[model samples]
Target chain A: MLRTQQLEYTYPGNKTITFPDIQCEKGSQWLLLGQSGTGKTTLLHLLGGIRKPQKGKVYVADQELNTLSSTALDQFRGKNIGIVFQQSYFVQALTVGENLQLAQTLAGHSADSDRIKDLLSRLNIGNKIHDRTNRLSQGEQQRVAIARALVNSPGLILADEPTSALDDENCKEVIDLLETQAKEEGATLVIVTHDSRLKAFFDHKIILQ
Target chain B: MNPLTLSWKNQKDRPLQMLLTLLLFGLGVGLIALLISLNTQLDEKFKNNLAGIDLVIGAKGSPLQMILSSMYHIDAPTGNISINEVKPFLNPKHPLIKLAVPLSLGDSYKTFRIIGTTHEYVDSIFRGTVASGKRWEDLYEVTIGANVANKTNLKIGDQFHSSHGFTDDGINTHDHGDGFKVVGILNKTNTVLDQLILTNTQSVWAVHDHEAEEKQAPAEAVAADDHDHDQDHASEAAGQEDHAGHDHSGHDHADHEGHDHDTHDHADHQAAGPVMKPLIEYPDKDITTLLILYRNRTSYQTLSMPRNINENTDLQAASPAIEMNRLFSMMGVGTDALRNLALIIVIVSGLSIFISLFSSLKDRKYELALMRVMGASRSYLFFLIILEGLLFAILGYLLGLLLSHGGMALLSGYLEEAYQYEFSGWRFFKEELWLLGGSLGIGFVAALIPAFQAYRTDISETLTTY
Candidate 1:
């Protein structure tokens, strides 16, 4: 479960950048759609505990993120929030397995080998787990990023343009995977994207202008 | 990569920088180790060899110079004395008297000093019998030093003419009438004993026999002239007849002059038996300087002895223990300064490492955000950057140590040959080790900033940057 109240925030730079209020409960699929420079990313960052709002409170599973110490915030964020970036960047030195292992370590948990293998195999990247990251294709790398996000079975999953580089077929497949995983884990799923094509897949929507 | 693995990869990325850093550190570490090692070794040698029969009797001079020459076989000798002058203290039962070993310095065969003493020289100071070959059997017999044997390849039965003094140039040759035969080779004492050419007391006197003989020759000429009249000049007339006989034969004409001189010396030898020869008299030469070993060992002072001698004089008093300490402590300033310089360099290097990794982290903010989106934590990201810097520092330290020893090893051989002081192996001082640890600490501290920076990234801003 995740929620944000009144969530007022400024960019903390010279000019103020503010986020609209927001909340999400357990097992919900919410599409965060917004025009460019409409505080979508700023709100997403605040929600992930990366930026303290300077104005509002964010809660995940009823724990206030804004109140946590920087160190505590890091641990809590790593354990509870899963984010998919527009570009999935893996540690170049590590093999795919180590990338996932590091993710679990950051979350203060150990990797679930069987479950991770199961996810990779489902994504058709099972054999690539031991390979160096530079060897992976973009589609396969994105799948690994997804697997790493879900390694610790976090309470919430978030994606930024989760399928920006895929064809319609691959895009459909990635979205299905994220939705199915969130449902199976009973976790909240939130996606920030400009593509209205994925709008049908979500049960709720937050549109900002 | 695991942190170490990732850090190690940096060397591959900048091999030249890594190598340069290693070389610099190695030189610094190596020099320090070598100096300490030599000091330790010298201390051991001094402690071991300087045991036993207390006093060193030599000519009056700088007592320190006297001890150095007579005791350590180094430095110029104080002076020389007649063996007969030291006879008063030769008694084994005299009060305040213990067994004494006399040393006379002068002469060398190829830089190895020739010290004229009895077997007591080995018995007292060196404390061991010759490892190979027999002890000196004749006045002309010489003992090769351990280092001499190793370097010169001289074995028993080898003969070499000793120079008159400690100079290597063969300008002053000892005219001992008979050249010295190598009778023994001593074991490595690792002390100045390793550089001495030891021989009997007779050898010292015999080596200088030319001077005594020169003085005797003129007197003998006068005595021959006087003795001819006492024998009613018959022998002289017969000698004239012999000279005339040689001329008549003509075959012995060139030898006639030589025969006349031989006959003269033979007559003189027959007339004067023991009275003409110089002999050891112990106290009579007045031990120019006494190296006194006291029971209390509390101080260096002893009753001043007579300074004048029949043939010996220069020596100065010195205590090796106190002098050596003073010598080493004088280097404290240089050592402190060098240590400080090394520490500063290490700190600067650490700062460089921190700056390099920290900047790289900032540039990769989006990459880090993506990893977080893929489930990597701020701590994991933080550790990666910090570990890179820490690894760089550790590697640089190791390289410095190796460089130092390798360089020292190369230089040590040249130093020993040129300076006669051997260089040492890897030997870091206690304070030096602390400096090394401090360097690593600086590296770790420098890395902390970047690691913390990585921890506080705005996931959304960073993710969008991608």
Candidate 2:
């Protein structure tokens, strides 16, 4: 469901970072391990179509990310690729249900409240659907973020340090939730992290120096 | 989900800042709208009462006061002038004069001026028709104006005594003679005539004539007591006191005969109608002013008549149009200052909107980036900011209109009580629509820079940084 070849990026100061080839089949999970300054977040942004790489291409669901216009790329990312950032960020003014509805609408689809309710219940955050995102607990917010990423049933899920701030027990639980949800949706999951605790959970790994 | 809904949600997030912006803009718009309505209504009232009279001839004084008193009945008349002095112009055969209506003042019944004039003043000048009863014909018979009838409740055959001055203070009243009877009620002309009590010039003369006779009797008795003194001193002192008392009432029974002779000669030379008879036959009688119309207003003689009257005659002549324009310009200074202050307020409110939006945008950058990552385009954020500004403008404009009309209604009640002049607040002016357009322009311009910043939000940088 996702492929990238020779992805390269440069910082403003002309510091260049290169990536190895990545190919993950549909419904498979992969781990991209990197320490700080290895451009792990940059790779996740490139693969999710949030940023364009200087010299390479990213393909998700047989469509190249660089070939789409800016507007079309934003739509495609919303419909096909979901990214979970290091922090649980949300539109603070909206409630949980409304935020999910906004995501569905911004992707040029009509709102599906039943699907949103179903996803939130499966993530164990059904009671938080009417609550503001700011009022939720940290663990509850993490679950809500996961639910939001899968709200549109995207084919690719990119997670950047999703469990770095959690304790070992919570970290295990969060990873279990991500993997289980991705399996249920038949989406390819890629986790970019420096945490050593998640090393034994995935079979395929890409280590960045 | 939509730009408008998002904009509203963002505005609701900071209620105090939004309310402050709306209040400032509303106050600015309200003041300007009040001035516009006041100016429009004042202009309408002034022009409606001007009534085609070319020049006002009165005793020499402030020409504007003369126009206000005689044409508008809002001020005291410039002292009185003898009717004989303007009799030549009053002749219907005069080369330039179209019509001359005499107005004798100096009496009132319950704060309404008793205007002593001929039927020509009512028929030709005001084109007044009686709504009930008939017009005044004989001495001591009077016709009440619409507002006079309404305020005083003086119906037909109601008798009321005249007071000495323009106001009814209960002292200096004419109590010796029988009260003047209300013979007619005039239809509302929406002019100065709507607030007056109309009668022939003789009724005003006769009301003061009784006081004249009583003073003369006391003076004769005092003169008899002074006969024991030097004859010259006694005669001179008596004459001075007597003349002081009879200054406005100088006519006697012999003067009436001479006035009749003059009227006969005037009638023989001009076409005679029932309107042609002099309401007061005494030649030495005084009138407050003469409202004159020209046969051909653009003629050289007509144009020069005011200059001729001002320079050569003892009377003062002022054109109603000229004096009214002078009045407007004099009032314009204060209105112009207020209008400038309102504009400054509007500009300051625009700046306030800009600052509020700019400052709030700093904290919302992360939220905006989240929206971008959720598939919102750059233009979506841009339009959302613009829509917030427009919402403020539209709401403020409506609030301003409501405030201005409400204030005007309150002020109109006071003005009607004080001046007896009608000022309506329910009327709308066309200039208010332009005010709406100007307010929207302010909103759009105020939002321009902030919207551009929102459009240029870098999602990758904002997301990772915040």
Candidate 3:
């Protein structure tokens, strides 16, 4: 479960953006729609506890993220929230399996090789586990990035413009995969994007202008 | 997943930079280590051969050369002086003198010097004991040092002829009478004594006596006092007593009267072996040098003995300690320059490490931020960078130690051949442990700025920007 109320942020030079209250049930998928400069990425960062809100309350699984210390907040985010960035960035020095193992260890969980193998097999890239992330194609890298996000079995999955760079068919396929994986893990899913082609995939939406 | 593992992975990402940094660091450490080992071993050898003797008296020449030739056996003798000139110190009843050992050097066997000295020189001065056979007691008998015995393979009873000069040029070989027999082999004393062939002064004198008589026997009837022959062999015979008297012309008649009385008493014991005859009996003879030890080491008279002998007497006296200090100061200039050069190389290598890490941080920004997003703390990133630096330092240090010891082993061969002093490379010095600490400090300092940059990385900014 995830909830936020009256989230406010101020960038340098006195510009401020206030966000509407949001609530999502467990295992539900929602799309957050926003134009450029609408502070959608800022809201996602606050929800993930990657940045502190100037004025806001964010609750995930009964714990208020803003009230936690920086260290505790980092730990809570690693355990409960997973963010898939717009660009598929990875630790270039590590192979796909080692990257997944690093994510599990950083989340304060012991490495589970079997779980990693299962996740990679489900993503149809199990054979690429030992391959360096840079050696993968664009679509494969994106899929591995998604796998890294899900490796810790976080309660909330956040996809930031996950389909914006993909073709129409690939976009549909990526969205279906995100929805089905979140459902299978029983995690609440939030996708932030401005792509109009993704409108029919979700029943619930929050539109920012 | 650990900081060390991550650090190692990052280092492997840039192999060329790591190799360059390590090479620079290793070369700096290796040069310094080599200097330290050489300095320590050289000091040990020099100090060990000082052997408690207070002063060296030889012919008036370079005092350092006298000490080097007589004490260290590394240089040729500073020309020979008459045994009569040194007779006062050789007296056992002299108040200030504890022991005065005579040395007659002017010959060698296969480049190893044949030192004509008494049993006291080997036993009292060097504390040498025979490992096999017995000490030399008669003319033409030799007790070889351990290294001489091993190198020349001259076992007990084996005979070898002497060459006239210090080196084995094969031209001035002494084929007179019978070849000198190896009577004893000395134990390894780890001193200059380990490289000499010891015999009584009579054997050295008798060898030249035969050479002189052989060359002058044909010309003796024609010209009895022909001074045209070489001065070294001219002083070898009793028939050259006129040349020895000419050397004593500057002294007073009373001293001459006392010397003649002592020589008659020594002649009464001439039926005994030449080793037991008083040195005064060989008044017409010459010796290479005299090693003197004082009865009262701290006495003012003992302290002034060298200056007194240097100014008044025709002989030159040198303190081994004073001469060795002068030698060390002269050697210090070269070692200090080498040490400074090594330090500069070390500093440059530190800078090299800093540049490589700082530049590589640009390429690794995303990976570092990704670690932060995956729950690595600022301190984690900081220590990861530091661990990489430490790894480089440790690897470079080990490589440096290997290189220095290997170089020392190679250099020891050439030095041993040239100086006949044993040099070993396998010994370790305490200074090398301090070197390790210094290397670690360099690693820590070089990593400081890069690690701080990693610690200050903005995870959100870095993750979203790319």
lDDT of each: 0.63, 0.82, 0.83
- CA shift at A9, candidate 1, in angstroms? 2.6
The better candidate by TM-score, 1 or 2, is 2
Error of 1 at B36 (Å): 3.7
Supply the TM-score of chain A against the true chain A for every candidate structure. Answer: 0.93, 0.98, 0.98
iRMSD computed for candidate 2: 1.2
Which DockQ value does candidate 3 get? 0.53
TM-score for each of the candidates: 0.70, 0.84, 0.86
Q: Rank the candidates by TM-score, best first.
A: 3, 2, 1
List the candidate 3 regions with Cα displacement exceeding 4 Å. A164-177, B149-154, B161-178, B208-278
Query: How high is the lDDT of residue A167 in model 3?
Result: 87
Between candidates 1 and 3, the one scoring higher on lDDT is 3
Clashing pairs in 2: none
Worst 10 residues of 1 chain A by lDDT: A11-20
Chain B superposition TM-score per model: 0.70, 0.83, 0.86
Worst lDDT 10-window in candidate 2 chain B: B228-237
